[model samples]
Target: MITEKFRRQLRTEAKLWQTEGLIDDYLYQQLSERYQFDALEKTASSRFITILISLGGILLGLGIITFVSANWQQWSREVKALLLLTLFIGVNTSGFYFWRQQNTLSNTTNKKQKLGYGLLIFGALILGANIALMAQMFHIGGSPYGLYIVWGLGVLVMAYSLQLASLGVMAILLIGLGYLMGLSAVFYPGEFSWLQFIIEYMSLVAVLLFIPLAYWCNSRIIFFLATLIILLALEISLFRIFDFLNHGLWGAIALTLPPALLWGYDDIILPKVNSRIFQAFTRNLAIWYLSIGFFFLSFRAIWQDFILVNYSEISSEIHWLTLVEVLVFVGLTIWEWLCLARPNKRDAQSWRLDLVSGVILSFIVGTAILCFWHLSINEIPEIATFIINIEMFLLAAGLIRIGLARGIRGTFWGGLVLLTLQIVSRTFEYNTGLLLKSFVFILCGVGVIAAGLWYERHLSLEEVRK
Candidate 1:
């Protein structure tokens, strides 16, 4: 009998031949026998070099910081920031110089080729730092708009120079954080304002601009970048709806919301986005309706009353969203159905486990709802909604278990999606008092940390397998 290990090796071999366009019955049999045998060594060498380059960049950066800080007694804050910035400039300049040198080095020996790769890696790191510093210097931290400008330069330049996904990842992450910070400021205002939030969106616009560039260059990093940016932009727009209308309702929309919907468009947007994966970020078709109508309906209410429950503040005759909300919901439901019709590769990968977990959790929720629905009859389906909301807390616990047992990326991401829903569900949620809210938060914290232990166990198992 072929052991699982041997079968896996055969599968790897088959994949290799297919990639090489030498796929045939005989080639298949040859791969099933044994691989080229040098694949592991070649892969290991590449990985080792990648690690060295990454680690060296980190250590060098830290060393520079240490050396400069040790002389802080002689250097001012401006001087320190400038010195750090200059160090980054030097590193990036070296990268620029080395890239030119590569043409000449291409004819060199294997050792020289390895050195070229290392230099390229080092150069990429330097370029990353340079863009980051430039962003910082340009007021990335002080102003919301500044963040976008800096990130724009960083992301665009990094994609062009190294085609590194991590650089793109960093850009997307910063964009997400910028959106989060902007939203938090909007709801909990001190110095942060709508202008700053708009600035955050400006960076999003920049992301849109560069995604095409990344794609034209044939970088897969662009696809993920587009994904992150699209999801993030939709999230920000949704949060704006909350601030403009009902914060709690916004949370509702955020929770039940599907990410693919945010990036869904087939006839025009779909073909356009799909044509260039990097530029394919889409907005849920219903979103166009939801955001515009939501803004108009809630704007006066938010500006005039500040408190939603004080119906006395507004004229009953001047209802803004009389039937719009119903239509929006209907449209959203249809959009979600469309997305479910043609689920992405991620959805297909673990649909069985997802369905199983979802069904079980649904059963659990249905029972819980039956138990609690009578008490919450004062609320409509919103009660079932609330129960469903809390079930996310429980669902995450189960996903942690699945992620551990199955070693599936789908389970891991699914769990995180559920967790995000749980948090989004609670934003500006009706709070009876500090005490109740405190208990609820305690439950959330404890539950997540408990689930994290399972994740840690999964990591341990992975280590053992390695």
Candidate 2:
């Protein structure tokens, strides 16, 4: 997406180009019309006003809430219920009215629209309060998380009705909050609420509920949050059910599975749906996952623990739920891989361009083999450490290469940071002298500056060529 700042800069440059006779009036007009240069100032002003109004509304709402809360106990149930209903209806009605208001000769600004959106958001917050107050009035009792879940569901319905991304994001946060809080109740023996069912299969719920909404709203934020929720839910399920298994296996799966899914998201998941909107996000997340995972693995202490852990004490009994969940995701991944490979697009140049994916796949395989070796045969800690260090270095180098090839600054810097961190971490981790540490730090600093300058120059050249 072209940002407002970029558009503004382009507008200035276009004006300069026109003044210098580099571009004629027609071309300049085309650029102006396409970028809506004339409306930028108006849009900025509208946004500023909207922020001010929203802030004021928040303060006013807080005051009203505080006043109501102070005298809440003095009111009769009938009066209280009536007041709540009236407040909810009145606010939402006003919001809807303003939201649908047309701009007339007398009203040129988007203040009404902004005000309506803010009110709608405020009304949504009021919804949760109303639920809590009504419940309190009737003395209906359940877990706090259950209340949040219900509140979230209500907001979600509102989001669906209005197709508002803000409300959708709010709903996801509320539901996520409830889900996290409900984790405590999962292990506690207590009376079951229907919400327990939602908590149990939150991954499925998040996918079914939010994924469609994400596509409907065309919101990357929603998609990102939904993806994270699903991944976290699945990971939690695995840990909860498979806690009796070897920790090494858990570590291996945790390290490898997410990156694999994310790295192949475009190829495996998007093709079926015929959309690549989230490909970049998934790939970046995969890179981050691998980078962090490899950083941890590069430590000798972690490998020492892996080699020392007794696998024989682990339970052989299986939990069907966890097994099915694992099998489903693993099977899906494998099936998708096969489908992706069925096409005859495997050329040398294609392979070279996809060296990042190749490296990730190799890392996954290598990790699995390492874990299995530790389980099945005796292994040297140093050897494992050395192998992990090599893998980490390769990953960093791959990131740098890919970044340079693709001209992505973030990717390049990510790789640089990872490489620098590795060097520094190793320096501190090993029995090195102060002089050696100082020397290493200085070398890393110089290397970083040099690399950054070169990359910036490369980007400038690319831009010029374009």
Candidate 3:
């Protein structure tokens, strides 16, 4: 009830019990805590600024996507192509600009918030454009193989000028593969009429061109050459499948397959990945590919001899021997899956899904047998396939959402794996035309929803509103 001035004077007088303490632990500790908090408070402000800047970048990216999609369909094909080319150039330009800006890492020390923010904005815009271009191309009519060329050139430009050499080389190789596989389709109407060109003239030329460059400039060119060679071998195998190659030479083909698979290793995929983690991962995959390919080739060579007595039935799949082959294949798959999935799936690159895919593929080898054995797949089960794809797509989308939401790498890897499996599934599926296309849209919607929910959970309404 006393006056405020009187109370303050009373408190000060009462606390003056010891104005100067001799090495008091409590006072020293209190001083230290206050100093620590003062420093922490400064850090907190910087963090807040960073968060705001990141949110701004994300919003800008989404805005670009929304803008493009809103007006996309109204644009013509040539414009779309030009837009994609422009996007590619934009990305490369942004990367090089950032590299130049960030070189020597001194800008951050100099407190150049303006340069940093500018880089982020430009990079986010370029990324948005690239993604939009890819999305448009995904549904675009005619061949998409041409777009791959544009992407390759962009990567090349990014790598040399910006020093992202490994990624650049990797991208170039993928585009090179696209060109090799789809070139005939690009030039010819249908069928691989220029198969020999890929095998003889083209692939060798690529090896000659890329391998030496990798040696001198980047050493990652080995991966490019190796993968291209492996692709060449794969193309050869596909051609052999169509021509019904003689059973006698299957043994030789099986033995020689390992060499083609050697490129599946770090020597091939690592430089493209260009990280210790990725190199190890790719090496593991290479080993797996080699071991599995070896086993299948060896086992098939043995199986081929047993089926020679009724080769015609073997070709048509009425043979009892074909059933035995199926049993062996399934047994191997189950064993492989168990081994791969055991002890909590220690292997990051488990090929279990691919193995399952292979089993289904082998079953499809003889369509008559499949119709007699399992009819759900032989005659297009549109609704069921659609539902399954939906579930799979949801799961993939969920996992990616969770990963990206929490900034976890595992979730990204899982999402990418699921996408790969989906790609494989769709590749094998016979055309259901519009139904399949519609299913893809629904799956993409699920992914969009999941991503939105994750982002919304993390970002405040006010932050997003801007």
Candidate 4:
């Protein structure tokens, strides 16, 4: 894990030692060879050159875009399509030439290589614009999601063909946006429904396309980005599909998805993926999701909104896609549980089991409170509010404990901050007297200051001991 900069520093020290006669010429030569000091020295200037080359490519792209905009009204339909295609092919061909031309040189960080990468980026942008503009020119009618989906697919093809991580990242973003737009469009119907197919299997399509690209590009960022988008699309799609908002099924989802991700991470995801970055990103995301979910559910008004409001009877229409999603989640959870039951895995502290237990408890509590409210229990809301607030507090405490066990400072602070926010927010939200509220606020401030001082003192003592 020796970085290039550290290698260079080591090389400098070796050279100084050789000059002072502390190390022999043979040792210095060996150090140079081992560290590739010669290569490092040349690359020191290559990054600046790369940026300059990339800027040139960007400027060239802007010029083309400007020319097209200015002459748009002057071009015929056929000519417009031809012009877009020409720009797409021409820029990509030039990029390929610059990239292949660098094969003649030994240095990998040459200006030509950078220029090629930049040109490829510019070409990818052009390809996206081409898809949208051409669709408009052809009088094709579809949702914005359809246009983006087409553009994203085009960019994805380029990324896979070139195996460029940067392009792959761009493709992932475009696809994610397309999925989001499609989800939004579902709520707000447009003039056309032709593009609904893209939204139907959005998560599945994104996973299938981008997961392979992530592997091909050898980029952990792309992999996790893809995973995040898939989860999001699944969440939204499932919410609508199940009609969860009407039945308060959001609580079930909020409680389950985080644990499911964690389970997938441990049993299936990590074994196949060789990226620490992806693992860390997923783990943090799970913590944040759970924390936010708990904090959101802590409010009494939320429960009232779900319970007090009269809901209309939703149609019994079957949604096959939603059924598939439900089955998939169930199947995966069962599969993970079976895997964990293996002899070797039995000893492991299972995040899935912990999460399942909590989810079951939350579900029971929520159902009980709802039932009580239905049965004319006036005190149901009060009981539910107290239990939920307690649940939030315990969840925060559990997060801090898990963070301590994992030695993650961010998670620990995140949990503590959540706890603080809940307390402060509730104090203001409730109809407490002014004097009582002021006293509670002052008490919380003192507690925080005292806790800070104690933590500082503990850190000082630990440093002294070290």
lDDT of 3 by residue, 1-466 (tens): 3232443454344335335554355655564343332443465579789888989979998998799789889988777778776765665455445445542222232224344434533543454356546566666443445545445544444444434445446545655765665644422334333332333233344444454345335454445455455445444432233224434333233332333233222332324544433243333344344333323322222232432332332232222332333234334334543543344345566444343333323322322232222222233333323433554555456556656655655555556556555654464454557767777767766765675566556555545765
Candidate 4 regions off by >4 Å?
1-24, 27-82, 96-108, 188-194, 215-220, 241-264, 267-280, 306-318, 345-379, 449-466
lDDT of 2: 0.79
Candidate 2, residue 175: the lDDT equals 95
Which of candidates 3 and 4 reaches a greater lDDT?
Answer: 4
In TM-score terms, which candidate is top?
A: 2
Q: Lowest lDDT 10-mer window, candidate 1?
A: 310-319
Q: How many Å off is the CA of 416 in candidate 4?
A: 1.4
Off by over 4 Å in 3: 1-45, 64-91, 102-141, 153-157, 160-166, 169-254, 257-294, 297-301, 305-466
C-alpha lDDT score of every prediction, in listed order: 0.50, 0.79, 0.45, 0.67
Where model 2 places Cα greater than 4 Å from the true spot, the runs are: 1-71, 102-109, 187-191, 247-251, 267-273, 306-319, 344-354, 376-380
Clashes of 3: 0
Superposed on all Cα atoms, the candidates' RMSDs to the truth, in angstroms, are 13.8, 5.8, 18.6, 5.2
Best by lDDT: 2
lDDT of 2 by residue, 80-122 (tens): 9999999998988888888878853232435677678888998
Ranking by TM-score: 2, 4, 1, 3
In Å, residue 343's CA in model 1 sits off its true spot by 21
TM-score of each: 0.40, 0.79, 0.37, 0.75
- If ranked by lDDT, best first, what sequence of candidates would result? 2, 4, 1, 3
Alpha carbon lDDT of residue 268, candidate 2?
Answer: 28
Q: How much is the lDDT of residue 50 in candidate 2?
A: 77
